[model samples]
Target: MSFDTPDDRKYLESHEWATTDEPIRIGISDFAQDELGDVVFVELPDEGDTISHDEPFGVVESIKAVSDLYAPVSGEIVAVNDALHDQPELVNEDPYGDGWLLEIDPSDESEFEELMDADEYEAQIA
Candidate 1:
């Protein structure tokens, strides 16, 4: 199945994606949500919590399994998608939009350069 890997975001090898803009938004990629099947719950870090790059900041539980949601870069959590608490399927229905997990106030802009672009990420998943 084709995944929605938007050109505007950078991705992790493990299938999370993050916006490059300020207060960068972070979420699991379309590919990841599809693979996980229907999401049942999301456990996210509290606002103001600091998360390190490549570290687990939350968990996504699906019918298939529970997976750790990793931070794409070092940042403080500015916001989280509370909508997921009642409607986790948004992760499958609109991962890049309504399903977004966190907004980060990045600690290092340079860290974005270390992430994979859409093409690189597609190739890595291919």
Candidate 2:
């Protein structure tokens, strides 16, 4: 099935997508939330937490399965989606906007540059 993948963001092979805007906002892709069926819970890194590129940073639990949330770039987490704790379905409802997981101050700009662009991400998922 086709999924919404905004042209403004870059994506990881693990199905996480990151915004090109400042502070590096991130979340799971539309295809990911759909595959998970319904998200029941989300465990997020605390603000100020240090996360490494391509490393597991948190977890997203769904009725069908639980998945590790990987960081697409190395950075210090600046903000987290507090709303997800009470409303995990937002991940499925709006994966790119209100459902965004974290905002980071990237340690490596080169890493964000390496993440798959929208077209490349769609091709990968296809």
Candidate 3:
């Protein structure tokens, strides 16, 4: 399946998406979920757990395979979408919105600058 990288969201070559906000919400990209096939399980970090940029934070299990979910910015996890435990397919159906995996109150704002813009990320997957 092909995925369109949204111009509004910054991306990682690892196939995660990020945006700057009070608490950054992170999730697998549409491209990622499409490639992984139907999602079956999602393991996200607990609230208050600290994570570093580009580091593994959790796992996304799809019918095809299991992939590590990475932190786009170093920070403390503030929340996770608990709904995913019952409906993992949300990651495949709506990776950007309701399917979001976690939220982090960042350790440092500068870390978000390291993420790739949509244009650069499009070139990466192309």
Top candidate by TM-score: 1
lDDT tens string, model 2, 6-91?
99988999999988778999999999999999899999989999999999999999999989999999999999999999999999
**TM-score for every candidate vs. truth?**
0.98, 0.97, 0.95
User: Could you give the candidate ranking by lDDT, starting with the highest?
Assistant: 2, 1, 3
Residue ranges of candidate 1 with Cα displaced over 4 Å: none
Q: How do the residues 19-119 of candidate 1 rate in per-residue lDDT, one tens digit apiece?
A: 99989999999899999999999999899999999999899999999999988999898998999999999999999999999999999888888899999
List the lowest-lDDT window of 10 residues for candidate 1: 1-10
The window of 10 residues in a row where model 3 has the poorest summed lDDT is 1-10
Question: What are the C-alpha RMSDs, in order, of all predicted structures?
Answer: 0.7, 0.7, 1.2
The reply for model 3, stretches above 4 Å from the true place, is none
All models: lDDT?
0.93, 0.93, 0.87
Question: What is the TM-score (0 to 1) of candidate 1?
Answer: 0.98
Candidates ranked by TM-score: 1, 2, 3
Per-residue alpha-carbon lDDT of model 3 for 46-99, expressed as tens digits?
898999999899999988998998888889888989999999999988999889
